[model samples]
Target: MTNDMKLNKLLLTLSVGALSFIQACRSPESDEKLKSTIQAALETTPGIEVNVEEGNVTLDGQIGSDSLKQNIEDKTKMAGGENIKSIHNNIVVNLPEPEDAREKYHEIIGGAVDSTLTRDVNLVLADFPTITAQVKEGIIVATGNLEKSKIDTLKKRLEHIKPKGIDMKGVISR
Candidate 1:
């Protein structure tokens, strides 16, 4: 083959190789951008983790309620766009009470216990009616117009439906 023909063939091969490299590079950059967007959207949600692999996104986390989980999934779908072939949501709803119930007593009780406002033993004791209907994973210190019978009853109920780890103290009904 002539030297000029051989030179032309070499240049063509190099051009094709470079084009392939650029295309390959573009894919990963796009995937990274998608991953970043997904992470940003999920930042406010607690107990959730986001990961992207080969253009597929997976969301794993614990949501406070079932409705919140659905909201997260819908938002994720909107963010994925055309490049995202599939999404796997493994979100867990940590609602303590049954769905059909008018009120989630456990969640309400847990929230109150977890709140800084109810951390005071005196405040919790004075608010018996407000707190009695709730269930929490914490120590209960009773004080004030609470009767021993009432206190014992509350303690028994708490023990019966004890949440993972909780301790009761000074549960004396006044």
Candidate 2:
């Protein structure tokens, strides 16, 4: 081939190569596509929040279980593919609240203890109509006029009901 023709062909090839390389470089559009893909993948998952910027994906908010977290991460990777630069998982695993003794008593003892406690409390406070009693935090709090003898009797009866203790601070006539 002629020297001038060869030179022109080489220049054209180099120009095309440079243009392709520039086009292949990361852009805002690519990042947006990755974000869209991740959002679409996690659309059904509740409480999971996602943020994407410059091909970096950030996952945040709460999840119920560790298995769920793993599943979500795997799905995110599948959706994001090689275009994802990095993944920042800041998701928190939330546990359920523990059951309290009072709640268990209510569930198990139910009307049996409730009725007996009411009857016994009424018997103890029959003379003092102004006095009121309630069960709070596993303790029986009696308010208004009270006597030590009545308190002892109430405590003896309440032992059957399995209370933690009797709160006598509300009783004025101790």
Top TM-score prediction, candidate number: 2
Residue 51 lDDT in candidate 2: 82
TM-score of 1: 0.41
Candidate 2 lDDT tens digits, 1-174 = 999999999999999999988756678788778888988888766668888877788999875445556667878999999888789988896632222323433443343334434555566567566578886545577777666567666556545445556766776765
lDDT of 1 by residue, 1-174 (tens): 999999999999999999977754547677788888877776655567877776788889775555567767777777777757678988886644323221332342234333322223333345366333222344443333466567666555544433343344533346
Please give each candidate's TM-score. Answer: 0.41, 0.42
In model 2, which regions exceed 4 Å deviation? Answer: 1-25, 98-174
Worst 10 residues of 1 by lDDT: 97-106
Residue 87 in candidate 1, Cα distance off native in Å: 0.7
Clash list (residue pairs), candidate 2: none
Every candidate's CA RMSD: 11.8, 16.0
